[model samples]
Target: MGTATPHGARAHARAQHGTRTPTMPVVPATDWPAPPAGAGPLVWAETVAGGGYAHKVLARGTELRLTDLHGDACAHLVLLAAGRPWERFNAADTVKVQWNAYLRAGHLLLSAQGRVLATLVADTTDGRHDTLCGTSTLVLNTERYGDGATHCATPAGRELLTLAALKNGLDTRDLPPSVSFFQGVHVDANDGTLHFTGSAGPGGSVTLRAEQDLVVLLANVPHPLDPRPSYTSTALEVLAWRAEPTRPGDPLWDATPEGRRAFLNTAELLTCRGQS
Candidate 1:
């Protein structure tokens, strides 16, 4: 296993694996730099409405709680290691690593380098975590909702991601692929076709435990699978609190022995490059 380079360090895993190759991979011009600011201790949170964007550098051992204030809400998430933005969440790897397509409790969000970014510790959904539906774009939103919608409604998911990334010392190009929570998708095995349907009922929520210090970008725009009568957005809230320190016997570590190796790699990487 290999760790990430911090603040302004070289990426070491993308070539062997198809991880990100960024223009500013070593150091993004963001407010928070890897060795950590050391100015403030890690304790913070915020609530964002639907059609909103949020970005934060979440510390390791912290838990991020996302709540769907409304029943029909969707939250798209993009995650990257704080030290190495290039090492981002690999959805394909995650689906395959866990041997399950539907993201639920106990599923670990894997990075392209096979390291853990975050772990799904708890969820309040109807088991509809989706990766296939993708995100909504301005053009597509207009096409689906009509010309009036383009002008009246807030920006779609892509724009929201871009804006959030920029605020966090990243460009639109730095935005990682996203996972749409509270959205569901199923494939018609017989026909080999896929269909998007279902929701987590009302007040659905998910809790993620950060295994690595991370740059998290979130958008509360509608999911691509969403086909409501017209354009509708839902409000979502984000809460970050202290997470119990992870030890060798931690369930997530014990469940997936590989996860332990990944976390060690991240810890070592941060320790080394973060000090430089």
Candidate 2:
């Protein structure tokens, strides 16, 4: 008979040692062209209170144009890496990359790893948007609104964190600290707090050119405005070019002549609709 292996010895050895495993698959970054000067028209609009909600995932190289159909609209924006949860937008990093306090056209939105996620191609105002406003959230109890039974809704910074995690296959538990937009900063006893601000002037707008595929989210919360006409849209369109073009440098950055025309046409359409 063949020599019988010592079963107890083999079992003990197996328990004492483990086999090596292969590493996880590495995902490569996606390459995409930037948004052209004249890309498209309005997508959609929803009327929201001072504190409402909006969110979207922008693929690599997709341009997002935000228009303040009416004046004093506040938009809170956040950025994240396509697949890495830990690699998200850091305000400190963005500020250092741009070498300025506020973000404006021609600025690059840098990720924690120093990667270019999006580029600020155009803006109606000087590059001075507030980054410390924070997000809105749902409130369980509030004396100003009503009794404990009544619930109030508001935007919150946590929403962006949740979306970042969801996209990266990570749980919301791992969301990092986030920044805010369209808000003002206040200091009380040296502790910083974000206060609600008004919207930009009517017809004011800003547009971002994506360097790579990006996911974006936006929202509108209830503020001091009539619930009706809180949000309205003129038009939304997408224009694609056959080839990638050079970045348009600074000055005259508002959309190429063609883009301006498309925007104006959309605005007129909206005006006509309102009249009807």
Write down the worst ten-residue block by lDDT for model 1.
23-32
User: Which model scores highest in lDDT?
Assistant: 1
Measured on C-alpha atoms, candidate 2 has an lDDT of 0.44
lDDT of 1 at 3: 55
How do the predictions measure up, each by TM-score? 0.77, 0.53
Off by over 4 Å in 2: 1-37, 40-50, 137-151, 155-181, 184-198, 222-276
Tens digit per residue, CA lDDT, model 1, 16-88: 4533322112222222123222223335445566677777888887877777777667888999988688888
Q: Candidate 2: how large is its RMSD?
A: 17.9
Cα lDDT of all candidates, in order? 0.71, 0.44
